[model samples]
Target: MAISSEPRLGASTNGDLVNRVQQLRLDGQLGAGKNSRGGGGALLPWVLCGLLAVTWAGVGVRSYKNAGQKADDTASAPQGTAPAASSTNTPQPAGPSAVAEGELVTQLKGNVIPSLQITVSPRDVAAEITEIFFAEGKRVKRGDKIATLLDHLYVNRLNTEVASVAAAEAQVTRAQASQTSVAAKVAKAKSALAAAEARGTRATAMQERAGKDFDQARQQRASGSIALLDYQRFDADKQAADADKIAATADIEAAKREVEAAEAEVKTAVASTKAATADLGAAKARCAEAQRLVENCVVTAPIDGTILTKSADKGALVSPNSFNVAAGICLIADLSKLEVEIDVPERQITRLKSGQSCKLQADADPTREYRGVVDRVMPIADDTKNVVKVRIRAYLKKGEQQGEFLKPKMSITATVYNTPFTFDPSKDLPWGDEATRK
Candidate 1:
């Protein structure tokens, strides 16, 4: 299969050789020669040689024709035209300056996503869905009602808690009233004790005066100056005063005991009031919890966003326990702020960085190009895919609004650039520095 560079006969020479080989076959010269050689095999070699020569001649003619045509084409080509690539030679890569302007540094495939997504579900309790206010694709604001759950149970519990709180409050009031009554009783007992002490003092003074009087009277009787009746009267008055003193002492002791009893009752009442207040506080806490649960029955949007999906329907039972397994009432997302999540090959991850500019094109709408910036490079890598997760924040062009075209979970391709791309007014295309283009 070697190609000889030596001058070869053209098509005419090839035609003549073909004619000669045909004439020899027709004239029986091939057979005559075979007989003289005593075998047909000897003649076979000559025939084969002739056929090979004719093939080479035809190939040479074709090569010549191709060469002439190439020459003519070269002559007609405009000046400065690049030469055709040589199959034998490897192509040299473009130099940094030779690269086209605005060429992407790297391209990655990913999915469009919302900047924030939330799942709306019951907080802790399970309930049957009673109503849904928002539909898929509907725009909602923060605190807007999204759905309602069966709240009879919560309402009942709240009522019970309220009653318990009221009861606790009544108990506290009664204990406080009892405390006041006991305190008053204590005061009364103290007053009685004070009165009994005053009477005892009076009785002591009377007893002293009476004893003195009896002694004076006895002296008079001894002197025979006073009558015996007078002496006896004085003695009788002394005994009465002594008996009054003893009675006053007993009354004072009894009043002191009553004061002690009353003070003890006051302490007991104070303890009861404190216990009742604690119960009231506990009841109030329960009441507050019940109120919260009741409010939670009316599910609300957590942020201003669009409803992406509705997983729960009316009458469907939902619970926090099965939340991991079951979907929520609806999926909400902020469509105004979108992002692209890409798993860049580990080899290309080094070139990616936060704040780098990017261009995004959704598979569903490749004609439109969305602007984006590298938002983050996840610290962790995917072990199975040997890739690093990268996030890009997508933005609409000036005068463009976030529409339904770009949606969450849409497949998208992102072209990352080393620098921000600037629009070239004249070219109507993006442009960048030579380094960036390279």
Candidate 2:
């Protein structure tokens, strides 16, 4: 029989086999004679075919092993995480019973935020930060000191005002003393005037008695019953009484003038006292204002919360004009009150409603899922992005710390169900599934 050279297995396989056989014949491995029809020479094609089969078998085995290794690698490697991952080893929890078939479920990206965040800044006063009592992430209560500003200027102002108040009070006291002295003088003058009037009355009475005696003497002298010397003596007595009465009248006028002057002095003193009191009042007002400014220099927390960030450090200059982060001392927030802020497209805004249930997964910790509800859907929309902002009130599941995983400003993925779910802020059951409590 003649050996056919037809390529059966493949072009390359047949060519390789043929080339190997030719080379073997040239090398005298099969037989030395070309026309030699020995058993070895006749078995060459069968041996080559057997060798080819064996090579193909090894190749097939290697390929199978490689394919199996790839499959195993694919099966063992980690896969991409879903939007909301399961908190436990089990799969993600199912949506609430409120969700119906083919309901519009909207997926959104948002950031975690505190419901009440306060930016602490100095008001009205411009001063350099001297000390910081609290650091970032520190918890504090209302009225707790957070920072202190340099108060030397304010202290100096307060001291000046205090001194002014003291001076004003002293002035008021002096005026009061002067007023008392003048009032006493007025009383003394009044007493003197009364005494003068009494003296005048006595003088008039004596003058009248003297006149009666003189007249009686004149009548006696005319009737030849009195002597000339006695009459002259009576007239002298009347003249002396008249002079005494005139002097008494002059004394009374002097007393009246003195009383009037004293009263005027008293009025002047009262006016001075009133002015001094006004000055004291104004000084006190200034002092109180200065004290308030001094107290303001020490910044304190307005509410019970944790410090989010420290915008200004010690020795930094700050003022009310430098608002926001530029002059702010720190950011304080109530970590217990948390929310998620998302922007939904205008077309999808209709699908979102208040009180709708939502599932949240923070990018930082994708393994845990949080529960929340749509608290508000902003009525306004952004013209540039054509999206409306939405806020979802959220809370940590049971056994989780307030700010451990869901922190302010943390990026997260949120899934909102169109159906509304009953939510109670006091309970922790709705935050996690009953089967897999997180």
Candidate 3:
């Protein structure tokens, strides 16, 4: 029988392909041998047909392997992660979930952020930077000193205020001392007034006795029973006694006036003391204010956090409030309070709420995933983007970090696996069909 020299697609099975190829080689050799030099065209066709047959066999084998490879790729391809038409990356499945089968998830782009990022500034506007206490990126606790500004002026003001307070206190002491002296003068004045009163009483008694003696002498003189000289002498004694009584009365008045003057001095001293005490209090208050301002010059971390940046250096002027500052002293944030800000479509805003579980993947590190929870769902919508902001708190545990990867402002994605599910005991019935289990 003559061997046909034509390529056939279905004529040979894979089991016979090798044998067919061998037979084609033999046939081509026999045909070439039978044909003469002028019959080159006839042998050329068989040789070409044999080559085509071999090529086709190899192609079939390659197709079979390719088919297996495609099947494997399809099997391994995870659910919900289909090759996107516009995307270069075919996103893979995230971490394990507590969610059961058939649960839906919402994926969104987001950025990692610190819960609080505040720029630390000096309370004094004109404060000159003196020293930086902490290096950038160092963690500091609340009340920890981060930097120091020039506090010499405030310190000086405090000193002046303290001196004023001390001076006022000295004045108060002087006033009190004056009050003590006045009190002594008042006591002395009372003693002098008592002495004056005793002297006046003694003078009054002597004057009465002298007046009676003069009256008796005058009566004797009128009766010519005594000499005129004796009567004259008695009159002189009475006049002298009257002068002594008058002098004692004048001394008593003087003593009374002294008492009044001493009492008045005591009043003046008391008023002085009260006024000085008030001045002291006011001075002390000013000193406290100066001290507070001086303390303000020393910049410190207001919260527990790592220093994010430092814009002020030694000798730089710092201020708490300014229309523009080259930058504040520094900015620090609590890294442990790291979260992600996701922009969810306004249409899908209802799909999320607080306490919903989520999966977070950083763009910098995609292979590793971190768990998170929907910390907040902003009710307000951004009209420009038609999106609502959602804040997710990362499930970073306490003590030590599993991985120190999350950082503020890092681009990331949040796969919100927030669908709620409850396992049905009936669905878990053993070795039973769905209808039977129910």
On lDDT, the leading prediction is 2
Which whole-number lDDT from 0 to 100 does residue 350 have in model 2? 62
Each prediction's TM-score versus the true structure:
0.69, 0.64, 0.60
Q: Tens digits of per-residue lDDT for model 3 on 71-155? A: 7545433347663233457664453323443344567788988977888887754677878997777889999988777778889
Q: How far in Å is the alpha carbon of 321 misplaced in model 2?
A: 3.6
Rank by TM-score (best first):
1, 2, 3
lDDT of 1: 0.81
**Number of backbone collisions per candidate:** 0, 0, 0
Task: Report clash pairs, candidate 2.
Answer: none
lDDT of 2 by residue, 18-81 (tens): 7777776532653456546554565666788798899999999999999897675454222331
Model 3 / residue 345 / CA error / Å: 4.2
Candidate 3 lDDT for residue 12 = 57
Q: Whole-model Cα lDDT per candidate?
A: 0.81, 0.82, 0.77
As a TM-score, model 2 comes out at 0.64
Clashing pairs in 1: none
